[model samples]
Target chain A: MTSASVDESTRLAMYRDMVRARDFEQRAYDLFLEGVVQGTTHLGLGQEAVAAGFAAAMRPTDMTFCTYRGHNHTLLRGAPMPALMGELAGRKTGICGGKGGSMHLTDVPNHAMGSYAIVGAHLPIAVGAAWAGVLRGTDQVSVCFFGDGATNIGAFHEAVNLAAVWKVPVVFVCENNLYMEYTPIGDVIAVEHPAADRASAYGLESIIVDGNDVEAVHDIAVETIERARRGEGPSLVEAKTYRHKGHSRADPGKYRPDDEVAAWLERDPLTISRRRLEADGVAGDTIDAIEAESMIEVDSATEATRNAPPPDPATLMTEVWADGGSEWRN
Target chain B: MAELTYRAAVARGIAQEMERDPNVVLIGEDVAAAGGVFKTTEGLFERFGPNRVRDTPISEEAIIGAIMGAAMNGLRPIGELMFSDFLATCWDIVANQIAKTRYMTGGQVALPLVIRTANGGGNRFGGQHAQSVENWAMAVPGLKVVAPSTPSDVIGLMAAAVRDPNPVVFFEHKKLFAAKQEVPEGEIVDRLGAATIRNPGSDVTIVALAAMVSVAEEAAVVLAASGVSAEVIDLRTLVPLDTKTLLESVSRTGRLVTVEENPRLCGWGAEITSIVVEEGFWHLDAPIVRVTTPHIPLPAAAELEDLAIPSSEQVVAAVQRME
Candidate 1:
């Protein structure tokens, strides 16, 4: 159920990515508390396995679109941690020059193509990117990540059906984290499996995985993404996961029953991945070294972000048009 | 030069761009097989085939989203919305996603895309189908707006819109589709935000767009018979608005009157009025006049719609009132 059939290198890399994502998110949350990160930030603390597994499976040419809780996904895709933190801190050295802030971190060169703040906006957008593959004769698949909440939105249905109709290469991953915001997802959605139950509506197979387990998530990602690259159209994979923190800076997450919270925390992605690595006969020294390296990387990123200057006022008026100016009239 | 119907010019414009660049593709409802709801896209599917010219279900969101995504990647795509009024259904994608993606992504992505929609009334499409929505795009930042009145301008501005590195909302007036004009031969490329003086005069400036341009010309003739020399300026684009032409025309005429199919109250005419009053304040002999349809939904009844929309007679009457 864990990293049993996976190779030592693959398992190690998966564990390392998950640890890096966890460490970076933890540091970002701390920065938010210290008032370094202005505005609201949605941290993907307990959902690193989904981001790490999907990133590991995806190729460099492949593109990804995620929600506001997207720091883990962006960093796992090889975006420089300093820039990601810098963007969160509203610094000039940020990936988006601090204009996009935490929710809109984008590194198109690294294939982490834009995080959307609006809910359900990126589902169809990712489908559009995949449509480029179909038109241009490429196998580059586009991956879209969202929560169980997004599955009920109009864009999710439109995007899935259109991707099926056009046979575009895209994978829609729904991280069913049990809660939409303060309410449980099961309370709102009519179906049992939020995404997988609706897959049949678009003529796709229902695939549900243990999102807390890195190997399971990676295996599903590799399969569906490959299916898309092969021109087999789109697939919807629902990963059952949980958010360890509240929805945003404003939420204290008191609505969640204590037992449910304790149960999900017990299956934290980093802990699951590391325990699996140790069970696979990997040395404790090797496992400990990866965690230590991730800590050092996140620490330096935090330091660099704090020291960086805020974006110049000139950046405020730039990038409205591709001509490199916001000016509309001559 | 040859005479080309405004509808035929739509197909010709798309074909010319698609011929020049392999990246240019067309997507929308009935665009591929049925040649668009207005039949403006005839022969495109046949010429470009299914690869370049694709059709979709009535999924407006998907169509818009597909073009935005393609533009982000490599292809220069064009989406033919059946009607401009349908922009309401997918306003989120058009206004939020396509308009803001480049700016939000910090300009890493270039959205060289065009959304061509049939705009304005004449066929009496009721309130839902008939609307001059260039104002809708004009109100939003990060979107380029273009509305060509004549077939010649259509072929020219369509080329410019497709070539632009930003998202452009192209308003093709449905009423002008049947009208014909002499289009010059070979590769007509016109710049956006450039105003063309259709009929130059001195006494009063008549600013018009799309269907209203011809109406303005008709009123200019009636005004000429009455000794009021009215200048007719066709504003081809709205976002990169031809403010210089507007100010220059208003300065020369000492009076500004705008003719538009959009209802009054916050129409593009209001913005032009604000600009004229702000910049050309000293040049005014009287308050700026706006000859527009009363701010109400266009009725389904023929007589009601015709009476509600501004006419050449109304333009003449408004000019007379100004006198």
Candidate 2:
């Protein structure tokens, strides 16, 4: 049964965001196949709940820094789908003005720093942002999203240590998709549960959650985010999940076994959330309506991106220097 | 005017800026209690407190990344890399993030940050410690590079760098930290991208930077004795090069000699020469000469280290060769 205190409209809004993320990713995959989108894409096909759940619990003023596999993260952070699709299409109308492709989408107004292509590069940056917020006496909290592989980077250790020592208001969420590219988690990392175990090492609070369960992630994220806002320092939320797609467009995923993909797909967040929604006496027609509307939204964004203009040659010289002096000109 | 060493002047500049702007802070190794490896941050932690003047671990990437993040969030952070050679560890953040953030952000953000570090080969600190990497920073577009040779210039230029709205790389020559001069009292601001004429002469132009400015001045004196009047131009800032002053000096002299402590191959000297030939070709008489260190790692032995870097004699010889 749906919780009595949970407002129906709020639940519907969350469902809408989930559908938006799923539809956006599906459309992105279709466009990739159609050769309309260039460059490699890392799809969040099944892990939509983690981004939707966590982002829903956050305030618009809170900052987020994510990794390259961040399409869902950007979408859930309130970025316009058209801008994201336009960026993926390499058009000037896109976020970052098409300079940064999918892996580097940034919308500062929504408090989303660019998703760094380099693994673990944004860890220290997130920590620094949190430190600035704390020093400035702001209640804002900064969130960092990275994969299990990023835990091995030197920046992760250094950043976490500094955050713990300074008691900076920040949360580090590791989307442990059970694989670092093609290598299984157990093969590369010595620790079984990386984020939970690593957080304690830095003397910070740690929580482990079922990343596929939207309610489960939302509950824990709400607590940790509040603690950070209260200046209780940083916390690590290890969300255990799996990626439905290959690491990038190039990989056919021959490395993973068929049974493994089938097992993860069975517990996909979107399907689970839909089942929960239907079980709560949401009409089948309403579900269909939501799906139809999301499809329309995604389709329009695709068309808009298709017609978007390519960056002008003169635009390349711009944004390099803040003074507008063309240093590239010989 | 107050008499101070180059290191003390730099320390005073940082301390004063930290007091002036709450957003301006200092982060580096041993900057808090120990006053930095070169004492360039002396008494900063005591004066500004640890929150503003913080000590960092030996992680160069973290230091630079923290600075970039803080700067993006509207803070003027002056990060120190201790030795210029250590910059290699954080090259990705410096060359990619800090340098490209403003451009990539579509001018929506400004990285008003400064990275100050000591450089040069006179200390015999071995290959890892001694280096003149100004050329590497000069290659980056968004970064403004400054290397002051005197205490007066150090104080003035550092104040300007802290107030600048763009990222800057302030290269402090370790050998010149103890060199003393009269620093002006109160606040002093020197314009970035402007070269200072150290010695006005008529025969030839000698362009130099960092510790080499003193070498050029000494060489000018030596040249004056031989009836070769050499104009010494200290290129205080490398990236936003003051081509106007350099061209004027070169045009009047008709001969040019660039000197640097870094290796000759692909050094700042080459960039100056190319710019001169491109913009002021008609002013040239003889081929532009460059006096630079040999392309070899600095040895630990004092004698060998002395041989590795350029000296006043070498600069004088290069000027003579031009004649």
Candidate 3:
């Protein structure tokens, strides 16, 4: 309602990004099962819309901070598929040079700061980046992607208060995926609306959107991000969605009712986007080609990452300090 | 050379850095307007203005977290935690984020930050407020910990800390803030990982850290009168320890005594003792004695507080035991 209807090409692009994120996460999940990936990975399987939608709204100059389940965001931020997967496999050519596994992904050139493993810890850091942008007098907005669990942490309140007071250009996007790890947010948080209900306390504009609807997310993201870029201060956008996969590997998710899971699974973001694309006069063959291309991309990335060389032991002590201070072996 | 108090020297050092680089910012609780509770950052608020010099809310975690983020974003932020003891409240930011950012990012980003804090137990601040907790930072790999005893050392070392490529924790002892010394004029930056011999002697090596350096110096003067020649070495930085200087002194003296305000268990002195034993074992003619606070939290009472910190007499006794 704030702007013109999203074009057909942009709609197709959103669908494609969603498909790409889905394929990458599915392949990464398989890799985890096969023991090819070293540690556990938090997958954003059912929550792809928020990643693609918000990423679509952001400019190349804008910086992004994300949570542990951040591969989708990283890919949309311009990192190559091979590099991200390679990092997951602990290869030398990984995004973090194999130093950081899945939880820590940084693509500075692409403006993806890093994915923090700790919940709510990176919010303040994101505010700092936004403050830097404000100090430098640039239109760059720092977008912080956190989960529902982060809202309960002290850092969430501190960062939001600080950002609101300073009126820094920052967008706090909470991908409220119904649960925090294994625990449902309802059991933990006191509020009925986690992101929207709590916005006014920090003096921020709150928006609640169907996270499963990629187009709606895109529209709302575009508005909120523009508001931030215009120096309107920080805003909280809660993308209501659900995760298909468990919190981590081996979590069969026995806590949720079977009917609830089934119902949410039926409303999968990818399926909705695909259906919307077809209804929007986009050819079925074009959507099929996009899905097939995403599969091919994921396949090649996995193959390259599996074949990539492991990190050299000789280089293990490097990068601890930029000044070459206190090498681990030295 | 102008004589400045240790507190003034630290303030001047930060002021000089701010003048040199516009990107250098000071952010902490009570840093602006109040000029810091310790007054170490006095006059910085007025000189740098509120933008460069900021007074943050009493959120230690956010202060450090923001500083780390600002550093990564090409701003050099020097945040004060008020007391080194509050590091307990914000250890995660330092341990998981600041200490590991560069290494975890594979040198993709350099965090040029400085955490200036007040340390030591001589003040009647008691338990929580009066802990010399440099050992907590020394345990981390990426962090560089420097504690200066004299005004000259603080001014020079503080300048080096701000300009260092990595994150540095500048530990200023609470007792030495008012202590005056002749500081050299102009910009002076003492290199990290370097040790200076306060006094040369052939009998015993007295290695002291932070405020203990002065105690060792005093003990050295006392030892000289008793015909016990004790050499004093001031360890300016704890992380990149000047082991070569320590080993050389221990080799010449054939005796070692370490004095620190921290407890005996797992203290900075323990790290030095282990290093000496591992690398300089052959040079040691006697057991390396450590003059450290007894393993206990400092009590509030005046007498108990005085009893908790290592004294010049304790350093003298440790050196005599080493002999």
Candidates' TM-scores?
0.99, 0.96, 0.97
Using lDDT, rank the candidates from best to worst.
1, 3, 2
Relative to the true structure, how large is the alpha-carbon lDDT of every model? 0.90, 0.85, 0.87
TM-score of 2: 0.96
- Candidate scoring better on DockQ of 1 and 2: 1
Q: Tens digit of lDDT per residue, candidate 1, span A1-330?
A: 645667889889989998898888888888888999888889888999999889989999899999999999999889999999998998998898887888998999988888888788888889888898777877789999999999888888989999999888999999999999898989998988899999999999999999989899999999999999888899999999999999998998999999999999999988887777777789999999998999999999999988999989987788989988887775
Q: Write the residue-wise lDDT of candidate 1 on B1-323 in tens digits.
A: 88899999999999999999999999999999889888899999998899899988888888898899888889999998899998998899999888887777778788999999999987877999987778889988899999999998899999999999999999999999999988887998889989989999998999999999999999999999999899999999997988998899888989989998898878999999998999899999998899888899988788998998889999888888884
Q: Say which prediction, candidate 1 or candidate 2, comes out ahead on lDDT.
A: 1
Model 2 reproduces a share of the real contacts of 0.40
Winner on DockQ (1 vs 3): 1
Q: Which regions of candidate 2 deviate over 4 angstroms? A: A1-8, A328-330
Off by over 4 Å in 1: none
Superposition error at A15 for model 1 (Å)? 1.2
Alpha carbon deviation, residue A300, candidate 1 (Å): 0.9
Is candidate 1 or 3 superior in TM-score? 1
